[model samples]
Target: MGKRFVLEEYLAHSTSNVMNGITIQQRCNDKGNEAIMTYVDHVIQGFRKDGFLYILLTVAPWCRFFPSVRNVYKNIQEGIAKGNALFDSLIDQREKELDTNRPNGFIDSFLVEHKKNSPSFEKKEQLRIFLKDLLAAGTETSSSTLRWILVYLIKEPKVQQKVHDEIDRVIGREGLARLDADVPYVRAVIQEAYRVQTLGPLGVPRQTTTDTTLFGYHIPKKHTNFKQLMACAQRSKTLAQPRKV
Candidate 1:
C-alpha cells in the first residue's frame, strides 16, 4: 500500500501519461459536474459501498432481491466495470511502451514475468486485475489506516509532539516527509496504531475449497471469500496466484 506514493511516482516516471483523459476522473473532480471527489476519494467510497453490499450478500440473503439493493448492486457492478476498463487502458498503454529489458514499476515487473510465460501471468486479464487489485485496494486500505493513525495521534498529544519533534529533527519543520526518512518513533507509532485498530481481525476472509480439517477442526466448503475470489477470477479468466497462506 503506497498511499500517495504510487500516483506521485507514476506521474514523475511516466513519459507517456496514463489515460489522463478519463471522463470519470474528470467528472469526479469537476466542480460543475458534481461534488469534489478526487480519484482516491472515489476508490475509497466505491470500496466501502461494495464491502457493505458484500456483507449484505453474505448475511441478508433476502436483501439482494429488494429493488433498492438490486439497484445499488447494479451500480456497484457498473462502477467495477468502469474501474476495470480504466485499468485495461492503462495496461494496454504500458504494454506498448514498457521496456522489457528495463522492467519498471508494478505493471512493467508483471509484464516482464508475463514475457517469461509464468503461469500466474498467463493472461493480460491477470495483469489488468492485478493492477486494479493493487491500486484500488491499496488506496482504500492505506487511506483508511491513515485515518485511524490521525485519530490515534489526536488522542495522544505527547506522542503527536514527539512525531512533530522527530520530523523537525529529521526533515526539518519546513521539510516534507520523504519515503526514505528513518524515523523509528514515527514508525513505532504507526505499528502501534495498526495493532490497536485491527482492521479485519481474521485477516482477509478465506474459504475452504473443499470440506477440510484444520488442526482437527472441520471447515466447510464454499465460503464467502472463495465466492468473491471466483467471481473476480471469472472476470480475469485467471486463477489467483496465492503465494502464501
Candidate 2:
C-alpha cells in the first residue's frame, strides 16, 4: 500500500513548489533535503490534525483546546509563513525576469492577476489561504489516493495485469510523455479507489441558510454536519452487491 512514504513526501514538495514557487530540496544527498523533508513533515502532520480540530474550532474556537491542537495550529502557521516568504521571493524574481521567457507556475499567474485586477488586501489574504490549501490538499489527496490504489493493485493481480497491458498497448514500454485522457480503465481504477476509501471521509461542511427538507429528514435552518461520505459509500446499495472479481 506504500513506498516508504518518500513518494508522498516528494510529490508534496514538488507540487507545492509548482503552485507557489517554494523551493524544496529534492531527495538528494544534501543537508537542504533533510531540512526540506523536516518542514514538509511538519506541514503534513498539521494537515492530518487540522481535520479533527476544525469541527471544534468552527463551533467553539474560544474554548480551551488541547496542547497538541495548539501545536498543530502553530505548525500550520509556520508553514503559511514559509509559503508567504516564497510568494514574495517569486514576485521579486518574476519582476527581474520580466523580459525572459520562463515557464510560469501558480504564483506567476497570481502575480499577473494582481497587476491586472489590483486585488485588495483581503483578496491577497484569500490568495494566501488558497496557497495553503493548494499545498495541503495536493499532498493529502494524492498520497491517500495512491495508498488505496496500491492496496487494490496488490489484492487484484489480474487488475494489475490489465492495467499493465493497457499501458503497454497505449503508451508502450518507454512510458508516456504525458498520460492520455482517453485511458478509461486507469481512470476507472482511480475513481473506484476514491469511492472505496475517500481521502476526505468527512464531506465538506455547510450551513443551512433557510429551513429545508433533504431526503425527508431535515426541517430546520440550524447548523448541522453532513453524513460521512466514506461511510455512506461503503453502505451504498450498489456497493453491497458481490462482484465477480
Candidate 3:
C-alpha cells in the first residue's frame, strides 16, 4: 500500500504543470489534490501488481477469495491510518512479542503439524517454504480489504452513521465494541459494502481434481477449469434472502 502511494506521488508530481489552463506549483502545497490523487493511484497500482501476484499463486485454487482478502488488507491499512491507535499499538506489540516468543507465526504452526505427521521430511527447509507462503497469504489481502472498507464508509456517511449508531447501542459508551458484541447490523453493512464494491472482481480459478458429476453434468479432472464469479453470486436473489444460520 505504501509503495502504491509513493508511485502515485511520483506520477502526480511529474504531471502537475497545468490545471484549468493555469500553472500551479505542484510542490508548493504539502497536501495538493494532484499529489493526493497520485499517491492513491500509486498505492492502488502497487497493490494490484506485486500483491496480486503472491495472492494469485498462493490461493490459485480458490481465486474467488482474493477480492475478500484484498479488501481485508485495504480496510486494515485504512484503520491504522485513520488513527485507530489502539489497534495499531496492539498489532505492533503483538509482532514484537511474537518475534521473541515465536517468530514463525502461522508458518511455524504449519511446520510443527507437518513434522509430527511426517517424521522423514526435512522440517527446516519445509518451514522456510511455509513461511514464504504464510507471509504472502496473510498480510496484504487483509490490509487491502480493511482499507477498501474505510474508503466505502467515508464515501457513504449514512451507512457510517448507521454503523456508529448500532455500535453505540450495542456496546454503550462504557466500553469499546468487541468482536463478540451483538452488532449484526454492523456486520451486515460490512458484507453489503463488500458485495456492492468488489475489491477483487476477478476471483481465483479452479481446475477439477477428479472426474465429478453435478446436476447431471460430468466434469473431467484436468479438463475443466472454473472461475468463481463473485459479482454474479453477490447479485443472486437466494443470497439476498435474510435467514438465520
Candidate 4:
C-alpha cells in the first residue's frame, strides 16, 4: 500500500514519470507514432552506436522487471568497471555518441511534446528518465526474447529450415520481414517460442491492500504477501484446463 501510494504520487507529480500527462491529441498524432518507432530505432542505434552487444543482451531481462532488478543492475555496473579497459572505453564512446545523437532521435520528439504541454518541465531531466525507462524496459526484454527464439531455432533445426524456406520463398535474402507483412508462420513461431520460454516464471508480484478473509483465514491489513503457490493450492493431475484470472 505504501509503495502503491508512492507510485501514485510519482505518477501525479514527478517530472520524470514516463506515463504522466500524455494527451489524447498527442496520442493521435504522427509525433506519437514517431516517438514509439524511434524507441526501437534508438535502441538499435544505441547498440550499434556503443558496440556493446553483450551489455545490450544482458539488459533485456533486467528491463522486464526494472523495479525489482535495480540492485542487479548496480552489481553489473560494478562488475563491468572491474573488467577490460577497452570495453569501458567503448561504453564511454557510446554514451558520448548517444548524447550527441539523442536530439535527432526519440528524446527530441519527447522534448517537442513536453514544450507543447508544460513549458516548465525540465526537458533534460525528463529525457534522462525516458532514456532510462526505454533502455531498461524496451531493449532488454526484446533482446532476451530474440535470444530465446534463436536458441530454440538452434535446438530444432527442422523448424529453422522450414522458417528459412518460407523466408526464401517470400522475402528472399535481400528483403526483411516488416511488421505489417502477412507472415503467419513467423508469427506462430514467435508465439510458440514465447509460450515455451515463459519469461515471467514467477509472474509479477503484488501486495494485499487491506485486511481480507479467505477460506476462513484472516489476512492482516497492509500485509505485503503473495497468494499461496498455485502448485500447492491445486492438485497437478486435476489441472486439466487453465482458467482466466
| TM-scores, all models, native as reference | 0.66, 0.69, 0.48, 0.44
Model 3 Cα lDDT, one tens digit per residue, 1-245:
34534333333333322220121223313453443333334444556665555455445535435775565556435633532333233234434444334434443344446545876766545543333222222233444555566677778788888888988888887877577889998898777666665555665446788999888989998763545456464654666532211
Best by lDDT: 2
Better of 3 and 4 by TM-score: 3
lDDT of 4 at 95: 39
lDDT by residue for model 4 (1-245), tens: 34522222122222212221231112211443343333434333444444343343343544625555555455455533432232233233333544333333454455456645877866555555554444334444455566677777888888888888888878879997677766678788887666566554333345568889989988887665443344433444754432210
Q: Supply the global lDDT for candidate 3.
A: 0.50
Please give the ranking of all candidate structures by TM-score, highest first, separated by commas. Answer: 2, 1, 3, 4
Q: Is candidate 1 or 4 superior in TM-score? A: 1
> Residues 91-201, candidate 1, lDDT per residue (tens digit)?
776788888897656677777777787685346777766655555555455656666777778788889999989988999967877778989999988876665565543
**lDDT of each structure?**
0.59, 0.60, 0.50, 0.48
Candidate 3 C-alpha error for residue 206, in Å = 2.3
- The runs of at least 3 residues in candidate 2 whose Cα sits more than 4 Å from the true structure, single-residue gaps closed, are 1-38, 47-103, 119-123, 177-179, 207-227, 241-245
- In model 3, which runs have C-alpha deviations exceeding 4 angstroms? 1-46, 49-104, 119-134, 169-178, 234-245
Residue-wise lDDT of candidate 2 within 189-213, one digit each (tens)?
8788887777776666677888988
User: Which of candidates 3 and 4 reaches a greater lDDT?
Assistant: 3
Error of 3 at 140 (Å): 2.7
Candidate topping TM-score:
2
